[model samples]
Each structure stands twice: as C-alpha cells, then as structure tokens.
Target chain A: MTETNQAIQLNQVNYSITGELILKNITHSFPTGKITTLVGPSGAGKTTLFRLCNGLISRDSGEIFINGKSIDDYDPLVLRQTVGIALQSATMISGSIFDNLALPLTLKGEQLSEEDANKLLELVGLEKSLLYRNSKDLSGGQLQKVSIARTLVNEPSILLLDEITSSLDRVSQQDIEKLIKRINENYGTTIIWITHNLKQAYTIGDYTVVMMDGEVIESGPSDLLHNPKTNRTKKFVRGEIE
Target chain B: MNFLTLSLSLVFVFIPIVLSKVLKLELEKDTIIATVRSVVQLLAVGYVLKFVFDSENMIYILLMIILMIVAATHNARKKGTSIKGITWKLVVTFITIEVVTQTILLGFGIIPPTAQYLIPISGMMIGNSMVLSILFLNRFTAEIESNQDAIELILSLGGTPKQAIHTQLVNSIKASTIPTIESQKTIGLVQLPGMMSGQIIAGADPVQAVLFQLLILFLLLTTAVVSSALLGFLSYPSLFNERKQLLKKITTSTSDTEKS
Candidate 1:
C-alpha cells in the first residue's frame, strides 16, 4: 500500500494474442514481504499476468515497475532473476534432482555448494539423499517441491506461483502452503499466488485480489473472500457462480 | 552397361506393381508413376549433364549447383511449414553447406573444378544437407512445442534464449546426426554405396571407387553436423522475439501465425 513497501506495480497493463485481448487496463501493486493470492475462474488472465510480471512475455502496452524501477529499464534477464516464477506442472532438466535445483545458479556460471543444496532439499521437504537421484524418477509431489526449490536457488525478491498445488494431493498441497508461508515469514520474500481454491487462498494470503474476464473485480485484505465489496466478488466467493 | 541392359531394369518395377495388384495393396499406380518419373527425370538430367560437361563453362557449373541448392531448400522447407521465414531459413542453411563444402573441396585442391567432379559431389553434399535440415527442423519444432513450459521456466530463471533451448538444440542435433554416424560405421561390411557401385560397374578400379566413396561419405558426415547445428540456431530465434519473450507459436503454431 505504501510506496516504499511496494514490490511490484502495474499501470494500465494490457496484453493480447492474435487480436484477442487477454489482460486489459490492469492497475495494481503488491506489497513487499507479503502473500497476495489471486483468485479467479479459468481464463481470467491470472497466468498471463504472472508471465508478464517476470518478463516471460512482454506487455503490449503500459508500464511495469519492480522495486520502483521500470521493468524495461533493467535487463530482462536481471528482472527475471529478481522475479522468479514456478508453473503448475514441474518439468525437470534431464539430470539428477540436484542439477535441476542448481540450474538457476548454474546458468550464471555459479555452482551450488553441497551444503546449500542439501539445505534447500531439506527446506522443500525432500531428503538430502534425493539430490543424487535422477529427476525422471521423482513423483509429482517431489518434482513440484524440487521445482520450488529450484526457483528459490537464486534468492529472488518476488516469487510468482501459478497454481502449483492444483494437481497435488491434499497433503502435498498443505506442505507447499506451509513452505510458502514459512518463506514469507522467515525470509521476507514477496509472493504472488494464483489459485482457484478459495479456502487455500483465505488460509495463506495476507491480501486477496479477485479477477474476472481479464479485469480485476475486487482487491483488498484477506477477509475480502468473506466480506466482499462487490456483487461479482460475492457471487464468486460464495460459489454461486464459476 | 548399354541402354538396352539399363532399360531391362523395368522388370524390377513391374515386380513390385504386380505384387501390389495381387495383394490389394493399391500401390500399383504410385509404383508406375515413380518408375516413369525417374526414367524421364534421369534421362533429362543425363542429357543436361552431357551438354554442361561439353561446355565446361564455370557459369554453367555454378548455375547447376545453385539449382540443386534451391531444389533442396524447397524440399526441406516442407518439414517446418509452421515456422516463420522457414523457406528462407532453409535457403540460408542449404547455401551455407553447399558453399562451405565446395570451398573446402576446391580450396584444398581435393577435387578439380570441373563439371564432372563438381556436379556429382555438390549433388551429394546438397542432398545430404537437405535431409539433415529437414530432420533438424522436425525435431526442433516438436521439441519446442512439447517442452514449452520448460523453456519458459528457464527464461523466467534468468537464462538466455540460447540457454533456454539448449537441451532441445542438443537433442535435435544428436538425433539428426545419428543416421550419418551409424551408416558410416557400417559402410563397408553392411552395404555397397551408390557411387562406389556405379564406378565399379563402369569398369573403374575397385580401390579407386572405394576411395572416392570414402571421400563422399566424409563430406556427408561434415554436412550432417554443420546443417543440424546451423539450422537449429537459425530456427530457434523465431521461437522467441527480440524482447526475450516466448512467442505464442512456441506451444502451437497455425498457418496464420507462420508469418513474422
């Protein structure tokens, strides 16, 4: 909410593909060192917004600022390094799990120390011995956890997660939520999470933003799920409408 | 062999056509068409080669080489119809391979600058590079489509475009080059190649024919590696734009999006 505490800011951001507009005139800001959960129905542009935030896809028009600097001013690679993103499905590099985890550092010609690698493994709820195991042998939960660990290797300031827990079992989902909360609380990492599950969003988010048809419907405190300001948010949060 | 003996080889074509008719394979027309086309095409080429050899003009030789490269580019571009600028990309790749191979051969005095030597060897080089270009394009586009998220993930992690498609590029290069490697490994024991057998049938020494065939095979191996790597680099930038953003075509490309 305050200028100094803002981690990411979007001013009238718009994007499209093949003449079909995706995100339209979006304006919002995420506070640093807090969790902002994005809740919306399918095709509401949550994923596209995440891609824009990290420079995976450029915006058609409008400006994005990261930590008070225009995104285009920084090198695209440096901006991405500062803002890490993890997708729903985990795709491992063809190597041991350790290699996949260390890739972020490896691309910069840096190697992860054995101690740091094992520490990340334990942080993500995997055993250190799994480092040497082939990534192909990992289960879905294990792979997702490893993916999160991989994103964290660079110590990004802002982390964007796009429905990473949707495909996992309840236990794995809870484990991921806990890990995310721990990261925010302990490391002061700014987190933006997109999720369809209202309960999960209410449980972990310090702030919540609801979107519909490429436009933001309502954005406020976590209690916005229970005490929505608008009729569209009411219908969405009450499960009366998709 | 005389014209009569070569004409008798139509019996081989009849054998396949008759079998297809009897087995209800429905390939008789295709077999007949292939035989007729090859007969017409080879005879035309034979006369053209004889005329070109008689002239011995450098212009004619270069024209023939350019024609071969253009034909090869057209054929190879079919495999990557979804890629933007694919036709020109194949043109660049094929021309580079032809020029490089010819420069090496002539620059080193390995082969004389005569139509007889230049035409056949350039044909082999262009043909081999064409196949390699096609193989690389097919594998590269498929890899880009299937592993799109992985590539975007790498980009989001601060990796460059080269770093993003590194795995797919390597895999494609390896896949395209393996055929050349495996065939060369068993060249002598498993099969007698076309040029060597043609020479032997024409009464050339066995050792001399083998040596020429070896030279062709070596040139083919070099073209295979160079074409795959060159095409991979040329085609990958289309997957991402100048802003380092992954284009929509990375996942699924339509004819509509094939234009830059």
Candidate 2:
C-alpha cells in the first residue's frame, strides 16, 4: 500500500521474550480510517503487536510509522493518546463513571464537562445517568461501554481492541460490534481489532489479517478471507486448525 | 538504671519464651534472638550517646543522625526494593523528615541544639518514619500489583505516570498513616506511651514528661505523613518507564514477588 494509504506501517518487526520469538519478521500496514481484524491462535502475538503500536513496549528490531511518521517521533504519552486500547476486562478507577469518562482530559490537567461526558456515554450506547454512579457498580457489559467511552475521551485516531467482547454474552458482543462500527463510521477512526471468533473476524472487519504460529499467513478483503486462496488460510477459516 | 537492674529485666523476656515452650509454639528461638539483639543494640547506642554528649561536638551529632538515617533506610527499603532507586528514595525521605522536624524543634528553641537533645529526638523521628515507610511500601506495591490493569488503562488513555499511579499512591499513604493517627486518638486514655512512661520513671515531673511525649507524638504525626508522601512520590516515577508504561513487578523484593 502507498504510505498515504496506511495509518500504521510496521517493517520487519521482531519481538521476543526469554528467547521465545513472539513475533518474527513481520511487515504489515493497516489502511487509514478502516477496521482491520487480526485473527490468530492463542500464541500469535496479537496483543504484543498492539502493545508495540501504542508504544507501551518496545520491539526488538523494527521501524513502526504512524500517519507516515515514525512512532519514535511522537512522545510516548502523545503516541498513546493517538492510539488508545481497551482490554478484554474493563478495569475502572475508584470513582464515578463520569470521572472514568473524563480521565483523559483530567490527566491533561483539563476537565470534561458533564455535557461532554454525557455525550461520550451516549456515543458508547450507555445512559448519561450512569455518570454519577460508582463505576464499580456496573455489570460486565456496562463496564465495557464505560471503558470504550473513556478511550473515546482521548479522541484517538486509532483504537486497538484486545478481545474486548470475547468474554461477554452474545447480545453484548453484538452490541459492542455495532458500537465499534458506529465509532468507525462517525469518527473515521482506524481500528485494529483482535478476535478469536473466526466468523466475527470475517464479517465485522473491513480487512482481515490471518496470523498463526507468529506469522501472518494471509490478508485480504474480509469476503475473500472467508474463502481464502492459501491452503493455510483455508485450513484456519474451516476451523481445521487453531 | 544500674546494669543489675537492667539485667533483672531479662525475666520479662523469659515469660514469652517459657510460654512458647509450653505451648510448643516454636517461637522461643526467635524471642531469645530478639531479646539478645535489642539488649546489645540499646547498650551500644547508650554508650555511644554518652560519649557524644560529653564531647558536645556538632560533627558527632551529625554522624549520629546520619547513622540513624542509614539504619532506617536499610530496614525500610527492603519492603520496596521493587521500586527502582528505592534505596536513594528512602534516604532522601529520612533526611527530609529529620530536617523538617529538627528545624521546627531547634529553630523555635522547642529543644536545645545539643547532641543529648538532637540524637535521641532524631532517632525517634527517623525510627517512626522508617516504620511508616515500610507500611506504605508494602501497601503501595500490593495496590500496584492488583490494580496494574487499571494503571495501564489510565496510561493507555494519555495519563502520565503520576496520574496512573495516583490512586494506589494516595490509598497507600492513607493506609500507612492510619495506624499512627488512630493510636494518637487514644494516647493517654487507652495506653501511656512508652516515651512518657520512660521519662516518668527517670524522675522527670509527670506533667513535664507528658508535654515531652506530646511533642514526640506531634513529631511522629509529621513523620507519618511526610515519609509516606515523599516516598510515594519518589518511588512512583521509577515504576514507569520513559514510554510511560508500568514496569514489571519489582524483582528485588523477593517477599513481595512471592506474595504476588
């Protein structure tokens, strides 16, 4: 892809821990303003890649570019602000839901007015009344919504999701998927989502990237990935392999 | 007190050792070791204080204060070695606590600026601060381990290291200081503090001893708050890297690592 077409580009990315190659010789580009689903087996290094993109951890050997600029060019906190992430289980600070929603601005020594905070809650498909409620009082689904709204408070151009809906009920999972699509459409955000659910990956993502055994096996349009050309990809799609 | 009278005090230690032996509690060895160590250490400190007081030298006073700080830091930093540079952070905190408390005491003539006056008071402040530091570190590290995801969540959303660790840091500070605050509330009604009891036993006026004890209690209040805050602020930055990510659990603290 052309540099301008990519929101993030990784060149020969290599990462290891304790002599185990978690990610090896990876080169990929995530297209601008599009949702890319990263599907892989349990040990495929999807979370590690997300950590690298957000500058939470350094890669062993690689050059990563965001918006055609080196990730190293941006300050770490600034880079994180540009690329937000939500974990599978939402962990809230000890405060009201509004405080959690307003945290991004609060960290910057600014305040998130009630109206703006409520707008964020509404955007995430949660009621504004939850603003004054103790964040810990929410259910798994509500907490995940608050987590997404909190990430949106940063207004990141890129959002990395780490199996956020995997543990939720089917209804909550669908709700999250719809919310993610809405977020992509309304903000034009570049999203890199990781999922173990093959069907969900093939359907929800605009582009699908398949990974297995620490390597990208194939990538293409989601429709094409459903019936991939490569035998490895074909095997993965048919649930014949992890 | 005479050496014979001090030696007689060893009987009080025997009661615990005897009880442990009868109950098969297996605490006799530890109790004996603690008794021996305390007796030796206090006697050594007493003789050293006697010489320093007679010399009336400022350098000697400074050395004694430094010695106290070194001992306190060594004990306290063991609890927080997972915190990067915990040794130096502890040293700075003890020094700050000493300076702040002594400045108020001497600068206002609350206490005479003599080795006799300075060394013992510095010892009490540094000793209390060291205990407070240990409590804070224990609680703070536990908070970090349990709430690591919360800290990372905040960091992922553009929070700085300070912002990320703020909740754990504040909570730990409050937890550590609570013991001191609660004990102070029931000071004389519940228990006569050791210092006041000691002063009265030394033939000091009852009212005068209580006043001195109150002064020490007030100094401890400062020690509790200052030690926790200073150590908390200093230790937090080291927990995160320049990338603003929380570093792995501090490896140097074997006990904390094992607990986790």
- Best by the lDDT measure: 1
What is each model's TM-score for chain A? 0.97, 0.96
lDDT of 2 at A102: 81
Candidate 2 lDDT over residue span B40-122, tens digit each: 99889889989999999999999999999999888988898788889999999999999999999989999999887899899
True contacts kept of 2: 0.57
Candidate 2 stretches with Cα past 4 Å from truth are A229-235, A240-242, B249-260
Q: Give me the candidate number with maximum DockQ.
A: 1
How do the residues B13-118 of candidate 1 rate in per-residue lDDT, one tens digit apiece? 9899889999999999999888889989989999999999999999998899889988998898889977789888888888888889889999999999899999
Residue B43 Cα positional deviation in candidate 1, in Å, after optimal superposition? 1.2
Model 2: how far is A170 from its true place, Å?
2.3
lDDT of 2 at B118: 93
Error of 1 at B113 (Å): 2.1
